[model samples]
Target: MDSILNPSTLKNLVFDLGDVIIPIDLTAPVRNFAMLANLPEDEVWAIWKEHNFINHYETGLLDDAAFRAEVRQLLKNDVWADEVIDTAWNTVLLDLPVERIARIQELKANHRLFLLSNTSPIHIRRVNDVLTQLNLPTLEQLFERVFYSYEVRLAKPSPDIYRHVLTEAGLVAEETAFFDDNAANIQAAAELGIQAVHVQPPMTIIDYVKDL
Candidate 1:
């Protein structure tokens, strides 16, 4: 599709929810959780490794209840599980830049837009809250449809999730271009023949599409 050229020649645009649509700064909550639990940052991080949850969820191997329970147990703490989850979850919903929101709207006019995220109902609710605060539109109205790991029982970095998006969106691999902050997820999309971009700050998906 010659993504390097102007307009990127994409028929559909699939975006990752976390850092792409919404800005997520993961460090604050991690440090706070560590201090509250009196645990080392690395140990805490290891305990809550996203791959453990994302991999299973993406493959439809784990449901929300089971996933949440596992996350709670991973803390191995005597504290309340809901509180722990809340703290960890809220930390990720750091901020959403208005500039990014406008950019997505701009692209929607020319191409089919879809959100493919490895997230849960709880997180989705929080995201909506943030969106409301920022005066941004909801997922359902913004894109064709929003794909969530908990809602769809599938996540990124797995072929199943990518397959689901492509099949449901009726987009050919070559016609679709994916943008995600996660490298593994982007690589997975690449393997499926979908053009993928790894999104990092100062190098946004919009930057890749500006001239187009």
Candidate 2:
């Protein structure tokens, strides 16, 4: 894999959603769950962090109803309302900053921008609702193609998903650059010959592409 990426050689840009484009706390849901279940935050956090349900839900193996039921089962509270489950599950989702949208718009001029995210249908609906409220363009308007884990039945760190996008877009791996917040996803893309960058916290995607 080549460590040096020349902006001039890049023709496509693949971006991750959470923590990359939109800000996500990732642990906000634990607090919400604790409050709803009247359990210690640490306890709820422990269960959530160790659960495989989230990955299953994101990969389309579990539907919304099944996922909610699993959450209730984990909390040992079957009396929880659907509203409570939704609120707790959505706590990690935050607004998409206007600056990031501006950056994407700017990048649109020269690159075929695409989105590949490991997210559930519920979260995607919430994100779209937020975008609507903000009077911003929908994800479709921002990217040429949007690939969600639930929709694609595949998630990041899986080479098949990366290959799916590349094949579908008719894009060459060496000519594409992928930006993700997870190190594992970055490694997967890199292994497939895509120039991958791990966009860490305190450093926005704009900062990563400013030099390009």
Best by lDDT: 2
**lDDT at residue 62 of model 1 (Cα atoms):** 74
Off by over 4 Å in 1: 1-8, 49-84
**Residue-wise C-alpha lDDT for candidate 1, range 84-114, written one tens digit per residue:** 6665757868667778778888988888999
In candidate 2, stretches whose alpha carbon ends up further than 4 angstroms from where it belongs are 1-3, 49-51
Q: How many backbone clashes does candidate 1 have?
A: 2
Assess candidate 1 and give its TM-score to the true structure: 0.81
Give the clashing residue pairs of candidate 2, or none. Answer: none
Candidate 2, lDDT over the whole model: 0.88
Task: Provide the clashing-pair count of each candidate structure.
Answer: 2, 0
Clashing pairs in 1: 7-212, 58-155
Q: What is the C-alpha RMSD of each candidate to the true structure, in Å?
A: 3.1, 1.8
Report the error of model 2 at residue 39, Å: 1.4
